[model samples]
Target: MQQIINFLIRNKTFITYLVLLFIALGLTFNAHSYHNTKFVNSANRITGGVYNTTDAISDYFHLKEYNEQLVKENRELRSKLFNTPASSTERAQLPPGDSLQERFKVYPATVIKNSYSKERNYLLVDRGSRDSVGQDMGVITSQGLVGIIENTSSGYATVQSILNTLSEINASVKNTNNFGSLRWDGNAPDVVQLVDILRAAPIKEGDTIITGGMSSIFPKGVPIGTIRDFTLDISENYYIINVALFNDMTTLDHVYIIENLDREEILNLENTTNEQ
Candidate 1:
């Protein structure tokens, strides 16, 4: 206490001057309208700047939550889209047993690990059996197809990336029955090969490619890529098309897993037929 008193007494002159200076400034600003307006404007600017900075920091921290919410909404929308019949006429023409609704289910997931350089590259996603993800489910992004779910654990699953050399998907040129097998040459990250498409399919450069709906895994019309170039094999019976992928396999993040509700039944019937 004595030390504080001594220090205050020693700085009394300076403290008095500082107090008077602040008082005088306040009086001057209050007495002059222009000064008062300028002071208020300056204070507002400082506070507004501070608030903006704080809001930006808060938004940055909430980005992950916002992304998850968006993914959920997208999953719902896609589920509806997949269930919708192509046309009301088509729906009426179909038998009640084959209602398009409830044919597929969509599950959203995040990529935890990705590989595109390896010959049999795979991606690990943050979804698994617990989330209803299963082996052979088709995975895709908003831009295009990713791959098929290969393995699963309680909380995670692996995707056999479409870039894998062993990957084979049924794909077709958009708006046509010209279908082919989509495979990777393990040579380029952005390009894959679509083999066995008949040369007379009226296809050209820049043609769009999509799933053929021939398998129970992926639905038809899901995007795969666009044709970049083509060449005839030695047999010249079919086209070897180079397709530029719409999705950058090297930068996968969020993905959706698609489950065909009738997959098991279809497979079982086919198995029984084959046995016969």
Candidate 2:
């Protein structure tokens, strides 16, 4: 306390002069509109520079998520290169009957949080309302189908993982018309079971399974995985077939949000027919 007092006393003259100088400067700026504007601008520039530097430091912690997003974008580009035309102009020249829900745009996003070890596991994606994402949109990685969007915020979205209890996908045996419901029974880390397929259906041990396009979320030919095993249910009307998922749900990182263009139209049409 004594040191502070001595220091204040020693600097009293200089401190008084500084205080008077600040008062004079403040008065000058208040009297002149031009000086006031200049002062305000200069203060804003200094504070903005400091704020920008702080923001840059904070953003450094998000590098992993950003890199994952980059990988997803790269995969989308590759998918378009291999399958879809590079530009809309090129597609305009193609045959008229090529339109479908799969031809719609896919936005890339990173899976910040993923789960597959539980009975009703869900995944959290980093894209959300700000990126035009909404509930019920299909989310999938490059390897295979993943899940559907369940909820969204300004900067994030939660997906109902394929491993969830309520998750359902329309699938069929490759090269045959045997369609069934794909569900996870809370077992098998890398496998899901196909149910409701008739026992009479000729399902080989290694028969391929794929999205049936019965629902508009996935394209018809999008490759799922192959069958691993099978067993008859107690009623014997259907067979329980094991499916080895192409995309490992446990190790997922990046994914695409598929926006089915004709989904609403088809749904509305189906409702109209049901009401008849």
Candidate 3:
């Protein structure tokens, strides 16, 4: 206590000068409108700077939650795209109460594991059977297709990446009827091979490739990639196209799993017909 008193006494003159300086500054600010306005403006700037720094930190911490929300929103938007109405002529040919929504459903999933360096690369996603994700469902990202769901547990699933050697998807030239089988050569992660396209098809180097929708897997028009190059095969009957994938297989994160609601019925009917 005595040390504190001595310290205060020793600094009394400087302390008094500091107090008077503040009081004089306050009086000047109050007496002059310009000074008051300048002080208020300065104070506001300092407060705003502090608030901006704090808000930036807060937003940085919430980025993951924001990203998940964006993924969900994207899934909803894709669902709407799949359910959009057809042209007047197409709608007229449909049955009385049929809609596109009855055939397809989309759900969001996060990729927990990804491998693209291997020939048989597979991806693990956070969604599983519990989330309505099942075997043979198509998985895609906002940029392009990812893979097909192979196996599912209660809370997780495995995806056969488009880069896998065993993977095969029906794909076609965008805006045209030329269709082929999409496959990987087990060599390049960014490129896949599209075979069985007729030689006469009007294929260009930069032409876009999309899902064919011939099977019950992916919907029609889902973007796959662009044709990087093409050449005639050994037999020269078809063009083997090299497609540059839109999605970077090594950097996959958020994905959407698509389910064909009528897949079972379609498969059952086909099976019955085949029995005959």
Candidate 4:
């Protein structure tokens, strides 16, 4: 205590000067409106900068969640685009002779896994037996045809991609309805081959191709793609069509699964007749 008192006594002059200086500065700012305003503005500027920095850091941390939200939104949009129902007006007014109509059920699912690099590509979907998904169900995206569901678990399903060598889609000409078989070349990821289409069937470069409705997999009139090019075979009976698929097989995301409601009954009926 005595040493502290001695030191205070030694620096009393300096301490008093420092005290007076601080008081003077305080009075100057308090007395002058301009100085007070300038001080307040400087304080606000510092606080705003701190707030913006914190906000930026928080936003950076939430990027992944935001991206997931975007993916979900995209999935919903595709669902709406592909699965539109019959409007009330359309349902009330059926054409007199529209008897051969086939209805399709669309089930929306997300791709949990995918493979494009392999010779026989397959995709894993986030829906399966629990969701009523089963073997032979067709899978497609907004852009175009995808594949068929080959295997299923309670909560997941695997699809045989259209890129697979063994994959086949019953297809037909869009307008003429002359049918053909769609197969993958196993070389090009984007290009597929359509065989058994007669050369004299009014085939053109931009002619549309769609599901043939001959099998239970895909319903009729589902747009597969358009003819990119074609060449007559050596036999010269049918044209080998090079199809440019509408879907970007490498960038697949949300897909719609199709269920043919009457498939089982129809198949059973056919099987019984064949047995008889």
Q: Choose the strongest candidate by lDDT.
A: 1
For residue 18, give model 2's deviation from the true position in Å: 66
For residues 18-126, write the lDDT of model 3, one tens digit per residue. Answer: 9999988886655343112223221123443454455456557767865885777679888876777867547646774476545788898777666899877767777
Across 1-276, the per-residue lDDT of candidate 2 in tens digits comes to 999999999999999999999987886665343112223221123443454455457557867865876688688877776786558657656775577423666898877666788776767676778889877788876677898887676666777777876778899998899999998888876889899999899988888898897987776766678999999999989999999988877767668898887878988999999999
lDDT of 3 at 27: 69
lDDT of 3: 0.81
Instruction: Rate residue 108 of model 4 by lDDT.
Output: 92
Off by over 4 Å in 1: 1-98
RMSD of 3: 22.4
Give the alpha carbon lDDT tens digit for every residue of 169-228 in model 1: 999999999989999999999999999999788999999999998989998999889999
Off by over 4 Å in 3: 1-98
Compare candidates 1 and 4 on TM-score and give the better one.
1
Candidate 2: regions farther than 4 A off: 1-103
User: Which residue pairs show backbone clashes in model 1?
Assistant: none
Instruction: Report lDDT (CA) for all predictions.
Output: 0.81, 0.76, 0.81, 0.77
lDDT of 1 at 36: 29
Model 1 clashes, total count:
0
